[model samples]
Target: MRNPSLAPPINRGLILRDFPKAEDTPTVQDTNENDTNWVALMVRVRDQRDKTAFAALFTHFAPRIKGFLINSGADAPLAEECAQDVMTTLWHKAAQFDPARASVATWIFTIARNRRIDMLRRQRRPEPDDLTWGPAPEPDQADVLALQQETASLSVAMAALPAPQRDLIEKAYFKDLSQSEIAKITGLPLGTIKSRLRLALDRLRHAMK
Candidate 1:
């Protein structure tokens, strides 16, 4: 039940059943926990120029953020650079920290993810816009979870639909074809394709709700 963020070796130990760092990690914070509040530390750093507290938090969180990147397949140097960028952001945006919205670690990781992705995109620098369709940016954690939820919802919705409707919806979205395209491919009338797609989407919407 511990926060996975605190255990840098969890990814390394995924093949095993146990992780030692996890032993010292807490499962959850108390509602009123006040000691070493990261949000408050940022506020003090911003308003009172409290470098001491800021340094402590930065030192603790930076390596953890770097681990997240390295474990996700980035090289050590890139991860460290991204980690530094994340901390620089913390310094500049200290006044913007909101404890209620996310934990300090989550905020740090989100910054790291964005900065790392930006670095990667710049490094790859996809072909000129005219030469290629732009590559999609990798989704952050929130987007990934939202996509997974959408997949799950779609699965359930598809299951709830009568088989024929699910098939139509699949052909429409997953196959990325127009109704007329699907009609031509499936040898059905365009009107029938449109009707099936509409009815299928309606059922999916209701089922998802």
Candidate 2:
């Protein structure tokens, strides 16, 4: 493994830009210094159980994981909690990181993905057996095409929305908050929140067609 001290400083901007960049970004050799190989850092963590290496890894990934969870519909507090859990798991399971199979970012984000799913499932109340969901139906060609088209249109429409509407939509869907919750968070009336959502959905639907 390469010495951390000799590695180039890790670019925090690149690390946050995309997880794939983690595989390509250099790691910091010193916990106090900012340059090193990520793969090497993981190896150090695995072979020596190096706390510095683990700290370096945490510094790089924790906030990104939290943002990812938040973007995937988790609340801020839940995202923070899940991100911490993911980092702790990475520290303990560093030996399992396989550079050949995936980059360090991919591996870490996989853990984040799984953790988010588990958190969401836990948040959902258990339903009676009779109300339990069954296997989902496979999408047919037309349905698949229509869904794809709608997704593309919605993307465009969302980008075109005024800042206020866009922010509301993000809070409602991206943050997975209800209208009431969004109203409370934004200090808007419930009626105003509902009206904005309706307008946004209308524009999105029009764009989809």
Candidate 3:
């Protein structure tokens, strides 16, 4: 849990993009340059001991990691705690990331996902796949199975999404990441991330349809 006073100030001026924003056309980038960059960055951190580069990655992804958890339904404190864990793990395990196995967004999202699961350790039951962390509602077995199926379908759909489309969504929805966060992570202009996100959402809508 995060100290009430120590939370990084979330920018109120910031507005999160809607998911499946276009929902009419889901298009993947031919390749994710961000992933390519992360691969190189990971290698640099692991092999050369570049604190600057590693720190850059941490600064860029931390907020996105926080946003992703909040968007996934964690409260403010839990989200902040989760983000710290993600960054700490990244610092320790830079060598573990391989672009060949996953895109940057995919890999980070997986980490956040796993971290969220770990948080459930102290809870009596792991939160349902639906990820609602409020009061425990007794869901029937059929409802539970349906929720699992939905998560599985979304998970598969998430993997199949094109890099460009998925990138925006991952930063936005999965990471509850913002345009600014996306900009920082990929070193793209804010306008570029926003406009591109609109297009990507459209493509995702189409593909997921």
> lDDT of each structure?
0.52, 0.57, 0.55
lDDT of 1 at 33: 37
Per-residue CA lDDT of candidate 3, range 43-151, in tens?
5776677888878778878898998788777898999988999887877866554433334555677778888766754433354352123212232334323322333
Name the runs in model 2 displaced over 4 angstroms. 1-36, 123-209
The candidate scoring highest on lDDT is 2
Better candidate by TM-score, 2 or 3: 3
* Candidate 1 TM-score versus the reference: 0.43
Candidate 1 lDDT, tens digit per residue, 69-133? 77556799988888888898988876555433334655676667667657766553332232121
Summarize candidate 2's per-residue lDDT along 64-123 as a digit string, tens digits: 899989888789998999999999999887766544333466578778877876798765
Please say which candidate is ahead in lDDT: 1 or 2: 2
Candidate 2: the clashing residue pairs are 4-29, 8-35, 26-36, 27-35, 27-36, 27-37, 28-35, 28-36
How do all models score by TM-score?
Answer: 0.43, 0.43, 0.44
Deviation in angstroms for 89 in model 3? 0.3
